[model samples]
Target: MARPRKPLLSRDRIVTTALALIDEEGLAALSTRRLAAELGVSGPSLYNHFATKEAILDAAADTVVGRVDLSMFRDGRDWRGALLAWGRSYRAALTEHPRLVPYLAVGPGLRPAGLRMADAVFGGMVEAGWPPAQATRIGALMRYFVTGSALGSFAAGFVGDAAAYDPADYPHLGQAHLLARHREQVDEGAFETGLRALVDGLALQYAELGAGKDDAQGGAKGAAAE
Candidate 1:
């Protein structure tokens, strides 16, 4: 018996498997040795690609963030639509990797995809006439909203075994199993509802700002005419 010469390893392969391990288990579940075993390579071999476990984690996080669609931001004619599209895609990516939300929620770190996403969002809003301060806040606001939605599914908490929730002690009233049947629908519905409300509020604010600007400009023009 003998081991393969190359040990069957690639940076992509290692990162993919590592992310899966973290997603299936948790952050603590990942280790250099565990990842090597999952990839069927020597533990020391992993160090050749990544200097440390943190590097691999960073790559994995970037992969998840990369799934988000940023194309909508290019639609300068409709910033609201672009924002809604961004929020939906961002939430979808995070929902797929719920376990990783905690780490990602803290910050983007030096991840390229994450940085690009921030840039696209902030730049799009600013280009659409939002003040710089507000544009910065919008990026942060959406990240918080999307990450919070994915952190722990509210529907999942109720959708469980028949007796998981006691009738007298809780609100579900033994309906946990029933809720379980529609967990996906409930959770998705909640995300959509919250996302729409946020965008709608922002739209109103944008309109108000536009009106204020027009008023100021008209007043100045009338005075100059006088």
Candidate 2:
């Protein structure tokens, strides 16, 4: 048989496969041997593209972060609206593969996509009149909020044992047993509530930044006229 023109594997294929493995069975399920079986190639071939398992994992994790929509950060859009939209998009990406939250929470590291996502958020806030320091903080704040939300289901925690919430010892949790059934509703509600609170609180600080600037300008003008 003649040799094929195209190779069977590529960097993107490796990354996509790694991501799927992590999504389905979690971070621990990913191994050179298993990934090779899934990819239908020799284990040594995996090393041809990625130097190590952690490097491949980082690439896969970065692929998830890259899925976030940054269009709202473009010119002419206000920060508040942009934040809400971005928050929804970000949450969507993270929630899809909850197991990868730990990898992402460790920071961007050397992942270009992750760094770009962070840059978009920080740059957009700075462009929207937020002080540089506060803009940095907003990036960190949203990251913490988003990653924490994706770590696990608050409702699922009470599952598997409805009777655990007894009337005498846990009277307040009488209805808590039903929480598992309403997992989606409760978790989504909590994420939105927290996201809104963060943006709303920042909006106040945003207004103050402007007010302080105006006050300083007025004082300077008055002094010049003296």
Candidate 3:
């Protein structure tokens, strides 16, 4: 029988299969041998496409990041609005693959998709009148917030048992036990509240900087005229 007309292995194919394996069985289940088996190739063939398991994992994480919509940062768009949309999309992407968040959080971001994401976010903020230093910090802050949110399960972790909270030992715990009933609402509400606060705080800082710049220019004009 003929081996095949076309190439049977490629980096894209390897990354896609690796991501599927992780999504279905989690990171622990992934191995070059398993991936090779899934791809109908020998274990040594995987080494041709990926140097190590860490490299494959990095590619898988980048695949997830690539799903995020960064079109909001396109030319002629409002940076603040774009940022809010990006944040929502980022959170949504991570929420779908919560198990992958840890790898994404620690993985080297040299991959194309990850690098593109960082560039768009930082560049968009700078275009919107933010200092480069501030943009970099804000980009990191957004990543931290989105990743942290993905890690939490407020409703599932909340203490639902009324008996768990003793009134004798906890006088102010009367309504605390009921929090579990509203876990989804509470967690979502908290995220929205914090997101809005972060955006608004940045907007305020931008306005202050603009005002200070105008004041300095006016003072300089007056000095020049005198």
Candidate 4:
């Protein structure tokens, strides 16, 4: 007798398998037929789970971003430590699925899990005393830096990849790359150092804002004394 058929499929398994296929063969290698074949099912079977190819890709993107640990700083952890942890986790997840980086860069999907993860990170910053506006700006900057760096590093070796530009044409760019290389374990070191500096810069801004608030209060009291 033939072997028994497996149980029913779910969205998570489909997303996980899609991610794995992309990791093993790159994003260009993915397609509904390819995925179904790899999953031991017929092409039409995938349609029952995902309505279109874009939908599947979107789910894959969600799976990648969902791996980030945004709640690391929720328990009243130091603000700097929290931001650093967020940055590191973001970098690692994106690096693991470099081909998915483009989709991730477009921002998280409309899925509930995606929204919750973002709120958790931003909420942590607010709880640590960062105003919503400032927190939002700082978060965007950190993401740009981390994602941009990972994109460069992941494509560094592949020629004809438009993302890889020649440093010789840009002197300062060349110099910065040289300095980065000089640093110990440059890849990891650069991520941490850049994150700390970015966070520190934000802290300075917050301090100045606090001082301005104090000054205004003191001026108001002085005028009332007269």
lDDT tens readout by residue for model 3, 1-50: 98888789989999888877877888898898999999999999899878
The number of residue pairs in model 1 that clash at the backbone is 0
Once fitted onto the true fold, the runs of candidate 1 whose alpha carbons sit more than 4 angstroms away are 1-7, 159-177, 223-226
Q: How far is candidate 2 from the true structure (C-alpha RMSD, Å)?
A: 1.5
Best by TM-score, which number? 2
Best by lDDT: 2
TM-score of each: 0.89, 0.94, 0.85, 0.79
Candidate 4 per-residue lDDT over residues 98-217, each given as its tens digit: 777776776766865567767877888787778899777776787788778676463233344333445556544433434433443656677777788888987898789789889999
Model 3 bad stretches (over 4 Å): 2-13, 24-26, 37-41, 170-183
Please state the error at residue 195 of candidate 3 in Å: 0.8
The model with the greater TM-score, 3 or 4, is 3
Pairs with backbone N, CA or C atoms under 3 Å apart (clashes), candidate 1: none
Higher-TM-score candidate of 1 and 4: 1
Candidate order by TM-score, decreasing, is 2, 1, 3, 4
Which scores greater on lDDT, model 1 or model 2? 2
Better of 3 and 4 by lDDT: 3
Worst 10 residues of 3 by lDDT: 151-160
- Tell me how candidate 1 scores on lDDT: 0.89
Global Cα lDDT for candidate 4:
0.77
